[model samples]
Target: MADPTPAEVQSYIEAGLPCQSLSVEGDGRHFFATIVSAEFEGLTRIKRHQRVYAALGERMREQIHALSMKTLTPAEHGATQ
Candidate 1:
C-alpha cells in the first residue's frame, strides 16, 4: 500500500474524531499533526495520543510508518496561540 498523504491522514482522523482544529504535515513515511479537540480536555498526553491512534485504526499499522503529534484541548490550543 502507498503511504497516506497528510490530507488523507487528516481526513482519517476527522472521520473518527471530532476536532476543533487539525493540521498534518508529512512525507510519505513520517507525519506530524497538531490536533485540537474537546475530547482531549481531561485526558493525559498518552491517552490523547491513544485517541488519535484509535482514530487511525488499521491504517496506523498498515500504511503510515510514524506519527508524532501534538494533541490538545481547545482551551490548551487557544492558550498556545
Candidate 2:
C-alpha cells in the first residue's frame, strides 16, 4: 500500500478518538500531531501518548513508522494562548 497522507492519518485518529481540536503534519512515514481533547485531562504524558496509540490501533505498527505527538486537554491548549 502507498503511504498514508497526513489528512488520512488525521481523519483516522479523529474517527477513533474524541478531540476538541487536532492538526497533523507529516511526510507519509513520519508524522507530528498536535491533539487537544477532553480525554487528555489529568492523564500523564505516557498515558496521553498511549491513548493516541490506542486510537491508531494496528496502523501504528503496520503502516505508520514514526509519530511524534503533542497531546493536551482543552484547558492546557487554552493556557498556551
Give the whole-model CA lDDT for all candidates, comma-separated: 0.95, 0.95
Q: Which 10 residues in a row give candidate 2 its minimum summed lDDT?
A: 36-45
- lDDT (tens digit, per residue) of candidate 2 on 1-81: 789999999998998899999999999999999999899888999999999999999999988999999999999999998
Question: How many residue pairs clash in each candidate at the backbone level?
Answer: 0, 0
* Whole-structure CA lDDT of model 1: 0.95
lDDT by residue for model 1 over 1-81, one digit each (tens)? 888999999999999999999999999789999999999988999999999999999998899999999999999988998
Pick the lDDT winner: 1
- TM-score for all models, in order of appearance: 0.97, 0.97
